[model samples]
Target: MFIFKLLVILTLGYWIMMLGDTLWARKLMRQLPASPKPGGSASTESFASAGLAQPRGTTAKELPLVSVIIAAKEEEASITETVKHLLNQTYPRFEIIAVNDRSQDGTGHKLEELRKWSQGKRQVEVPLTIIHVTTLPAGWLGKNHALYQGFLQARGQVILFTDADVLFQPHALADAVHYMKETEADHLTLTPKIVVNSFWLSAFVQYFFFALSLYIRPWRANIDSQHKHGMGVGAFNMITRQAYDRIGTHQAFAFRPDDDLQLGMRVKQAGLRQRLASGRTQLAVEWYKSLREAVQGLEKNIFSGFQYRVLPAAAGVIGQLLLFFFPFVAIFVLDGWVFWSYVLSIVLMLSVYSLLIQSLIGKIGKELLVFPATVCLLSYIVTRSVWLTLRQGGIHWRGTFYVLEQLKKMKR
Candidate 1:
């Protein structure tokens, strides 16, 4: 009974912290407005006259050119459509730079095809440029190297590094650019909608997103008092050219699989102005085709997110089991106050998920039902990633096997 009481106290304390964090994040999220509609009044110049958040080092009369850089490897499945959507963006002055990163599939051919197709469009002031990388240079991850290559050829004052599979609504860039201009943000990351095809996928992705958001406290990055919090998502990471250079560029984390998050860390460490906006209304990406695919896709970076360490990963897994899974099981076995405590934890967890799902999907539906199952899958993903990396003594990414020793050395 005493042990159960102690467990109850510990679990209650954990839930209270989780609740506080969730509420605070939700409060911050509520402060940001939704992405402006394409033909809406929220043009790039809308906030200019208000001077609420002026573009740094520039007059409000002219819009700065933005270079959208996409790094592609085996992305033929979605590359064409991705570029098509980008071409339709309502943002006035921006260029698209696509780097074909030595793809074994039709990705390179498709990019060239898109380049030709974009030429006939009247809206495009700058034509789509394609760089075909035929070889992988030593000591570099494919995606990171490809993005850096794109950066080298970019001419925009603002640079946006995004994935090949992400789809953008026409006003997406306009909304993002306006937000950055208004806030004078040096680095801005827009949260994209994760398109989940199946019911289980929705649950897993939503729960995973919730857990990650809680851990990172992305909104806290905006607070001047809290100097350490920062984040970047792969779908949309936009930064000024100057800020990018200040953070040592991609070369600082050249070999990291989790380059997006590393970029955010560098920005925070440098004391650059960083912000997060809810772009779910404008940006969407089908992260993985299915649960099996999701597991395989996460294998490359899940362990790397922990800096490829054992204890942290193990602790993470154990922590998830206790905080996420234990409540469901304990609720059934315990009685009286202990059982109610577990119930309260579940309630707190669901409340957070409900708020998060509403933000991501525009409405909260029934994805919360599979919460326990999603928890299990998340735990499984972390364990599988760690085990495979350790047992194979390396990670095979983008058809290349990187030795563990080499990866560890690059962690610095």
Candidate 2:
């Protein structure tokens, strides 16, 4: 019982500080200007009407060219829509390069068709190039390899790496370019808006983001003093061609599962400027269709985030159990004074949890109500992620089975 009390005291103190952090993060997120539909908002509107928006003091001719690259393995469901959105981007001095990475589905055919249409019809003002990879070499991960190929062929001053499933509003690229120039960032990643199809699953993503905010503190990415902490997003990652080359490019993170995140970390380590922004209006993606899929998607992340080690992963699970569920577990098992202490702790926890839910309302949208009830479900997902990763000995993504030993060697 004394042990429980000491743990509770520590947890409460930690969470109280976390509660303050979450609130500050919420305000920072709220301050981010949401890009509304073309001509809907004052700060953000149609690219056609606004013309090419250059940096505050720069002229139109001085704007840099931005190249957008997308790598897809089997993204037939969303690739068509995503490509269309990319072609219609408001950023005038930009090109799009879409890579069909050894896809078995109709994705390869679809990209070729899009390329031919763009060439013949002159539907898009910029050049659209497509590449199809036939094989994966032993040293490289498929998506990273695809991106590197695109980078090699990219001719723009700025290179954008994004997922094939992410949908961009007409002004998304323009907004990113403006932000990058304004902040003078060498690398920038914007968090995509959650396209909520499953209420509970979307809630978990929102809750997870807010929970991670306590540690990641993404809003501070642009602060010069907080350069040690870096943040990234797969939906949108824009970096200067020079920075990409300086950081060792794709070869730096050849086989890592958390490649996007590692890229951000590398950039920070190189003493470069990096920033993170919200894409609530400009960018969005259907992350998962169902709760089960969400669970499966996180399998590699939990373990990879912990460096594929066991003790740290186990500590994370145990920490979650004690920090969030201990009071409930003790309420039924304890007696008298200890029981009342447990009850008080549960009330305090609920309050902080409630604050986290409110902070994420803008992120998940419409399905925000499902968050407060999904804490236990999220915990189970974490435990299961650790279990699946250790049980399988390594990750199996797409068709390749990355042996643990090979990965550890590559990581070295």
**Which candidate ranks first by TM-score, i.e. highest?**
1
TM-score of 1: 0.91
Q: How displaced is residue 52 in candidate 1, in Å?
A: 15
lDDT score at residue 407, model 2, on the 0-100 scale: 70
- lDDT, each prediction: 0.82, 0.75
lDDT for each residue of candidate 1 in 1-412, tens digit (9 for 90 to 100): 8987887788788878877877777666733354433322344344443222333444333778899999999999999999999988756678999999989999999998887767776656566889998888888999999999999999999999999999998777777777887788998887887788898887778888877776677777676455576788889999999999999999999899989988987888888988876787788899899988888988766998788999998898888888888889998898998999889988877877787667645666687777888888988999999999999999999888888888999997
Candidate 2: tens digits of C-alpha lDDT, residues 295-351? 787765567776777787677767776776676778888777667766776666655
Strongest candidate by lDDT: 1
RMSD for all candidates, in order, please. 3.7, 3.8
Off by over 4 Å in 1: 30-61
lDDT of 2 at 166: 95
